[model samples]
Target: MADKKIWQELCSMVHPGHVFQDEPLGKYTFTKTGGKADFLVFPESFEEVQKTVQYAVANDIPYTILGNGSNLIIKDGGIRGIVLILTKLTKISLQGSEITAQSGAAIIDVSRYALKAKLTGLEFACGIPGSVGGALYMNAGAYGGEIKDVLSRAVVLTKTGQLKHLEKEDLYFHYRKSSIAENGEIVLEGVFSLEPGDVQKIKARMDELTFLRESKQPLEYPSCGSVFKRPPGYFAGKLIQDSGLQGTQIGGVQVSTKHAGFMVNVGGGTATDYMNLIKHVQKTVKQKFGVDLETEVKIIGEDLKKQES
Candidate 1:
């Protein structure tokens, strides 16, 4: 637990309305399951983010940057220290063939904005459910397109609260990972370079991809998207399906029947339930196919019961 004095100091750094203590994380994450955070702050501006981060570092407090809470699993024990949410920092603008988006702007909204502007390169991201920062952090991709392909440059806030612009080459994006994630830099905004295209054609492509996602994925249930990364020369979903693990249930979580790659929360699922189900799938897939499944979703936070012990 954080020192009471430090908490008070943090509360003083931001508006009372923007700072929350012991906030339930389940209410914010996509899976709708997790523990409470000691502090959750929604910063409306980049400067506010910088101030909060600087204070945390100076005071020797732990902190985590959250973006839309997609593709994440927080343990039932919740998170320690401060959790900074950038959701309120959403802003997007288009200039010529370049699109600039604040870190908190939803990727889907950005894709739609591109479509409205008759931009072509962002069609593949129309169905991605993460924010710009999250997408950049993980090099998020779909339908054979990834963020690295369109992003020209990004403004990042370093651990020491220094702002730096990293070009696409500096980002070093690869298979759902990026340098920003490795360096723990906070993405402030990004500029995407796209080409002119017919608006109707762009919309048609987005609609098609959206339909494909809804058709193949379990849209009805809560999940952290794909549970595992695809192994070399093999598809994770195909392997799980072939292993007959589809629809397998443990507690309230189950292997998605619609798509074997996803483990869904049917109802009242806990993070432990999700973790157990993940292990089961991994073991089953390995035994049947001799391929180890690596997780794509990020799992964090302490286990509450274990911490109490």
Candidate 2:
């Protein structure tokens, strides 16, 4: 049910066009499987964000901030409250040796910006799909480098709505995880110090990573990137492949034969299909090698649909 008061408040506080109802979140997500969000608010400025946040808080309504939806899976039942997509908040600029990017700006765009500036360190992220905010929140990495290697600081909004700057050390970034995710902190922007190098050289390195990723990954299918974290002493994909789980299907989702790390929706797949396939793979792998695998993708909301069935 729509809260009349909240509607009036949103209309008063935000641009009328920016507030959307029953927004189809699937289109926004890389997986293309989620249901509609109750409300999707796209704020153009920090003030709009603050207003939306204050309203949700004061009214005791739940809210979750979402980035570009690159590495996320929203459930079939979908999220109940408001989802604030920071994608519209994209802003990028350079100052001297430092570059600042708004949370919603694509990390790849930031990398490209740095490359144009002849800044070399962010090249590892040139092929990453998530926004800068999500990248920093998750300490996203590819190949050997990670956000911690170049990130100097970030501005974040606390769960309580207070803004503060956190240093790289304060962010507590580790492989595929960070303090922001652990503490439920909302990233607003980030500043990274990149050393200048030959733009041509930077482009060449980025091109190589891009080529390698595309050569192996199933870019055609909608997926939540790598399905599992690298298990110790072995690559997750290799283990799954060794277990002979390739092209395995539960409902419409299948383990990619090309790259066992991905669980792809072969077409007409739902979240239940994807999850069931994940469980099946886990069971088979554990049964085969006595090695328990861990998922890297974050699964939110209830998994009841799979359970009830």
Candidate 3:
């Protein structure tokens, strides 16, 4: 557990009703299998986020930035120190052909806003179930389009709590990885430059992508979108499928029969179940295909038994 005095100090920095103690993390994550957080703070504004982070740094309390929790797996022993959630910092604005959105804004909603504004470039992100910060954090892409294709610049909060504006080149985006991941900077907002396009055409593209996603993905169950990064010349799903690992279950978690890339929580899965299954798939795929698979999902927090031991 975090220090009570530090928790009190953090609570004073944010608005009333924003701080929670011993909060269950499963309620916030997509997999619904995490333990708890020592302290969870949902900041409503950028200033609140800055204040919280600054205080945590000055006080020497460990801190973490949590976006929509779509591509993360928290362990059963839970996270220590402060966990900041940016869901309430959702503010978006449109300036002519460009859209500026806060990090907490959902990428899907941003794509919809762009579509309504007749913007052409964000059509591929209409089905991505992550926030703007998370999308930018990993250079998220789909259907041949990526954040690197449209993002002009972003405002970031460094680990030292200083703000900086980073251009597209500074982002260093590539294949589900970004400089932000390496630098540990917190994305505050992004300005996406788009082009004027036919509204009907943009809508058509979004609809097509949405249909394709729904048809193929196991959206019915609880799981992170994709568990592994795409290998250089092979698709993660095809590799797992060809290995005959589809529908394989470890405890309550199963490799999706619909898409082998996904590990789904059927009913009562735990993080251990998911991790064990991921290792099993990696070992099997490496043995059969000689290609190593890397995880795209962010896994954090300690293990329950580790604390007990």
Q: Pick the candidate with the highest TM-score.
A: 3
Question: Which candidate, 2 or 3, has the higher TM-score?
Answer: 3
Best by lDDT: 3
lDDT score, candidate 3: 0.93
Screening candidate 1 with a backbone cut-off below 3 angstroms (N, C-alpha, C), the clashing residue pairs are 77-304
- Ten-residue segment with the worst summed lDDT in candidate 1? 1-10
Writing each residue's lDDT as its tens digit, candidate 1 over 1-309 gives 346776677667777688888899999989999999989999888888999999888877889999999899999999989999999979999999999999999999999999989899999999999999999999999999999999999999999888898999999999999999999999999999999999999999999999999999998988899889989999999999999999999999999999999989999999999999999999998998899999999999999787789
Clashing pairs in 3: none
Q: Could you give the C-alpha RMSD of every candidate to the true structure, in order shown?
A: 1.2, 2.0, 1.1
Quick one: ranking by lDDT, best first? 3, 1, 2
Each candidate's number of clashing pairs is 1, 0, 0
Against the true structure, what is each candidate's TM-score?
0.97, 0.95, 0.98
Q: Which candidate model has the greater TM-score, 1 or 3?
A: 3
Which stretches of model 1 miss by more than 4 angstroms?
Answer: 1-4
Per residue, candidate 2 scores C-alpha lDDT tens digits across 182-226 of: 998888999999998998899999999999999999988888888
> How much lDDT does each candidate structure score?
0.92, 0.86, 0.93
Error of 3 at 256 (Å): 0.3
